[model samples]
Target: MKKGLRGLYYSRNEMDEMVAPLKFALVGKFSSGTPSIARIRARFAFWSSKDFSPSAESLVVPVWVSLLNLPVAFFHRKSIHNIACLLGSPLKIDEPTTDYTRPSFARVCVEVNHLDPLVNDIWLGDDDGDITQKVMYKNLPLYCPTCSHYGHVERNCLLKAPKNKNTPDVDSTSQEDLRIILDKKKSKLVEQPS
Candidate 1:
């Protein structure tokens, strides 16, 4: 499940301010696993506000905590907590809490599995968070390796020029390579004598 667009002109620190006490998964996390109530429990964890940096509209949970609760966190398909306890994994039955007092917001994350065969698992929702927004139905686009972008699904990228290359960034790129690209385009036009 995707939320609405989160980042337009938010800086690292600014993002923190808006989504303070909110946690999110970094781009490189692996939350795609089989959809089991138990495994879903493991993905859920507490996210500290200090380390709450996350991708646009994507929530981030702590790896350590999410990993621990894998077995009995999610109750989507079935909530057989008693059965789980019989096997040894204990279940936590508490009200969802995302208090501002604590630095970390604890959540139970489940592997976002896709019902359709084509699309990847969009994050549906977490057991310990409020993801009941209307916009969540319009899932956020999947991550892309080629353009290094999110928001739009990779297959949907149709722009001629790469968008990220044009964004003003913190690190200054050397002009040598950029100049070469500009020159290459110029020479291609000259070939037509235009």
Candidate 2:
């Protein structure tokens, strides 16, 4: 992975170090003309310079959000930045968007707080008339609202408390109990006629 990253963003004075498992902190001179790092995706991994620590209670991730059907007048840098602010802190705008090569949509990298409900669409224009612009996200991470964290959905949130007392907490379930349950299921399956 390190070699692949070096090949992609080559810099003579670049320094890369592993910060955590499957995570790396890269310090290097990258071309400003290059596409936004948020847009770069390799398999299940994405790149970001955001200060997202492992122990952070709140979840934040850099996401490439596309504002579809945006008016041509709003294609400029300032306008795109303002629109991106409605979603999150604007990180960087794609080259195509700044160059006006892709008029269909304006892509901007934004630092999105996962705890907040994402804006699906937004109204653009004055009081006389308005248009609904669809907001599309690239590689948005799974977020757990209950825990206010990323990497898991609400249903699978580890911090969520059980409604009934009899309902065993998944984490509290003993290894012996799990083994016994598995054995019982296996026996039941074996006893059934094939």
In order, the Cα lDDT scores of the candidates are: 0.34, 0.68
TM-score of each prediction: 0.21, 0.57
lDDT string for model 2 (82-190, tens) is 7788888788899877766677988999988876778777665542345667789998988877877778888997668456764455587898887887788889999
| Cand. 2 TM to true fold | 0.57
How close is each model in CA RMSD to the real structure? 18.8, 16.0
Task: Indicate the worst ten consecutive residues by lDDT in candidate 1.
Answer: 60-69
Task: List candidate 1 segments past 4 Å from native.
Answer: 1-112, 115-136, 143-174
Give the CA lDDT, 0 to 100, for residue 71 in model 1: 21
Cα deviation of 115 in candidate 2 (Å)?
3.1
| Candidate number achieving the greatest TM-score relative to the actual structure | 2
Distance from true position, residue 143, model 2, in Å? 1.3
